[model samples]
Target: MIYLDNNATTRIDDAVLDAMLPFLKEEYGNASSLQHKLGRTAHQAIEKSRSSIANYFGASSKEIYFTSGATESINMVLRGIFERYQSIGKHIITTKSEHKAVLTTLEILTKKGAEITYLPLDNQGNINLSDLENSIRPETILVCLMQANNETGVIHPLAKIAEIISSKDVLLFSDTTQAIGKYAFDYAKSGIDICCFSAHKLHGPKGIGGLYIKRKTRPIQIEPLITGGKQENSLRGGTYNTPSIVGMGKAFELISLKYQEQTAELRNYFENRILQEIEDTAVHASHADRLCNTTNILFKHVKSAELMPKLINIAVSSGSACVSGDRDPSHVLTAMGIAAEDALCSLRFSLSKFITKEELDVAIEDIKSAVQKIRKDSPIWQLYKSGVL
Candidate 1:
């Protein structure tokens, strides 16, 4: 199958696998065990990997906390902060178009009496900066937003968002999962107090990701989500995931060496073909700055649920992988003011560095033919053709 769902997860890079092989095999040891040489070796590897990823985000090694994935990282940081800071103030500002990881976690926080203000998105899948500024209040202790959207790949104006809180004591947290390997984000320079991302989104192994907690002289006090061991400098508590951590470092090395430039070109070529061949198609967030490797499209008279089954060769999705089982229309699209009918008709195609022009050519042909076939059989298409829909 032609894999066009990189936004969900990417195939592990060969180099990443090579780096992790020894850790999984002969180098196996608990990083917390320091009495033996094997344990010391494992500990060293974990620290080196931590330092590498920390440097990428403009953070110190001590501030990077490893977790199972972005989901756990999100929950850990959000819940930890809320638990500690709820006494001072209980307000959180975020957008309605966030992933289930953020949205669902916020729901739990609300139950604990933390007030949440969800900013609405515009037609192009962007939150209004003015609305964001107006939403902030004296009791607001945190602003949680993602760097790039998972469904539409639209980038949030983080620099502008940061500017809004430049003088405020409120912390700024961004879910950097979709944008980490694809773009430039400087946590220190941008004044982002906290952020999280997963390795699987960047061509590394799953089951590994990290949270960046900006260090201060006084130290930030976040209640621990898991309190047992001393892993992650008391931020996260558990045994270090040695192999996956090694793999994550290698994934970043590969991105810096080549994947960024290659993937951008491939995405452009793929999107150009889709627009040229498809009739009555709408590319979500096309007018806004977006991640280079993603495209969310609406095939005007066809439902994506029906079209996806016909285009079996091309792997794609309707929305975030975490919420794919829901039969209802996407919340992200609805937040951006897309009609429920068109949101159901939308499909997200995310290209990666591994894809080729020849593969894209086949995808374009198969996708075009499938849309035509589905639309021909669809009564909705007939109504749209008659200008009655």
Candidate 2:
């Protein structure tokens, strides 16, 4: 099958799987058990993996904390802050197009008396800096933004936002899940206080991820979300999934320049072919800086539910996996001012590092064929052709 849903989850790299094998078998030991030799070995391996992953984002090993995935990491940051600092302030700022992980957490925070201000996005899927700056108030404790959008793959101007919020007293947090493996991220330079990512987005195991908490000079104060053991320096409590952590290290280490060069070429070629072959098709965030491995297309007269089932050989998504199964239109598209009908017609195609021209060619053909068949009885297409739309 032609897999183009890397944003949802990538196929595990063979090398990463190979590195994880030993830990899943004879080397399996609890990282917290320091008394035994086997347990000590596991603890050392986890620390080594943590350091390796830290180097990629220009962070130290002490600032990284492991989690089940981005969802858990994000929850810990948002809810933890609200629980710990409600007396200081209960205000948080975020973008309208954030993944449900951020949006939903903020929703729960509101119930706990946290005031939220959701900044609006422009047509290009970028948050207006002016709107963001104007939204900040004395009560604002955190500004939660994403490094890049999941549905459109649009990269936000996080550095500029950092600079804007730097002079202020509020902390800046970003959900960097989509940007971690696809683009270069410098945590120190970006001025992000805390950020989250998932390993599965980068060809690592699905059940592992990390959080980068910036400590330029002093550590940021955050309360424990799951209070139990002293794992992750008492910031997070749980037994480490040693094999997944080892595999995550290998995956991050393997993201080289060659993969970026190859995947960018495939993504551009596929997008070019789709626009050329299909009439009335448009790509979201076409004028903005987007991830080279992602392309979100709006099949103007077709419904994604109808189109997807027809293109059985190709795997893509209408939106994030968190909400893809629902009949509701993608929140990301709708936030960019897309009509509900058109939003339902959008499809996100995220490419992996190993995609080739041959796979793309077959995919292009299948996509075109699927759209043609799906639109055969579509009243929207009929009305458009009749000039009554």
Candidate 3:
């Protein structure tokens, strides 16, 4: 199958997998134990991964904390801050299109009586800066937003928001899960206080991800989400997953070396083909800046769910894998004010660095034909011919 669902998750790079095997087998030991040879070996590997990830983000090694995925990392930052600084501020701000990891966490906090304001998005899925500014109060302690949207690949104006939040004393937490290896990110330069990412999105193994918190930033002081041992700077406590974390580091090293060139080509090739082909299809959020490999499209009369199955050879997502099984309309699109029927017709196609131009050609041909058939079969198209759609 031609896997275009790279945003949802990606196949671990063979080289990264190779780097992980020894840890999973011969070196399998609790990283917290350092006396024994096996444990020492595992401990060294985990520290190396932490250092590697920190260097990639221009952070000190101590600032990096590993977790199961971006979801957990986001929760760690949000709930941690809320619990620690409850007296500092009871209000938080976020955008409407954040991944459930951020939104649901905020939702739970809201239910617990923390005030929250979800800023609205413009037509191209960008957060309104004025709304963001207006939402901030002396009581607002945190502002959270994702660097890049998973569904549309639209890059949010993080630097602008960071500057705005800087004016206030509020801490800014950005979910960089989609932007980590695809685009350049500098936590210090951006003035963001906390950032989180999943390795699998960057061709690393699943089950390992990281959080970066700036030093001098208020210590994330929430009770541990999982408590057992004092590990991960006492912020996250558990024996590390040596193999997957090592694999994640290897993935970062390899991707960082070729990121600029690969991503430029990625964006260029996809845009060139889509512009030349794909009649009657509208690229969502095309006017906004986006990551290199992600493309979300709305094929007017076609059902994305129905088309996805027919194009089984091409792996893609209607929105997010988190909500893949749900028949309900993608809340993201609906929140952006896309019509319910149109939201059902939208598809998110995230390309991989490994996808060849020939594969894109084949996929585009498949999509074009599929759309033609779908549109022809659609009763809405017949209605639209008489100006009824």
lDDT value, residue 90 of candidate 2: 89
- Residue 62 in model 3: shift from native, Å? 0.5
Write model 1 residue lDDT over 272-324, tens digit each, in one string: 88888899997988999999889999889788888899988889999999998
TM-score, structure 2 vs. true: 0.98
Q: Report how far off residue 276 is in candidate 3 (Å).
A: 4.4
lDDT of 2 by residue, 1-389 (tens): 99999899999999999999999898888989989987998898898889888998888898899989899988999988777777778889997799999999888878878899988888889888999999998888899999999989999989999999998878899999998877765677888899998999999999899899987565577877787888998888889899999999998899887788788888999999999999889998899999989899999979898899998999989999999999999899889988899899999999998778999999999999888887787887988889998
> What lDDT tens digits, residue by residue, belong to model 3 across residues 313-356?
79988998998888988878877778899889889888777888
Q: How are the candidates ranked when ordered by lDDT, highest leading?
A: 2, 1, 3
TM-score of each: 0.98, 0.98, 0.95
Candidate 1, pairs of clashing residues: none
Error of 1 at 97 (Å): 0.6
Q: What is the lDDT of residue 3 in candidate 1?
A: 97
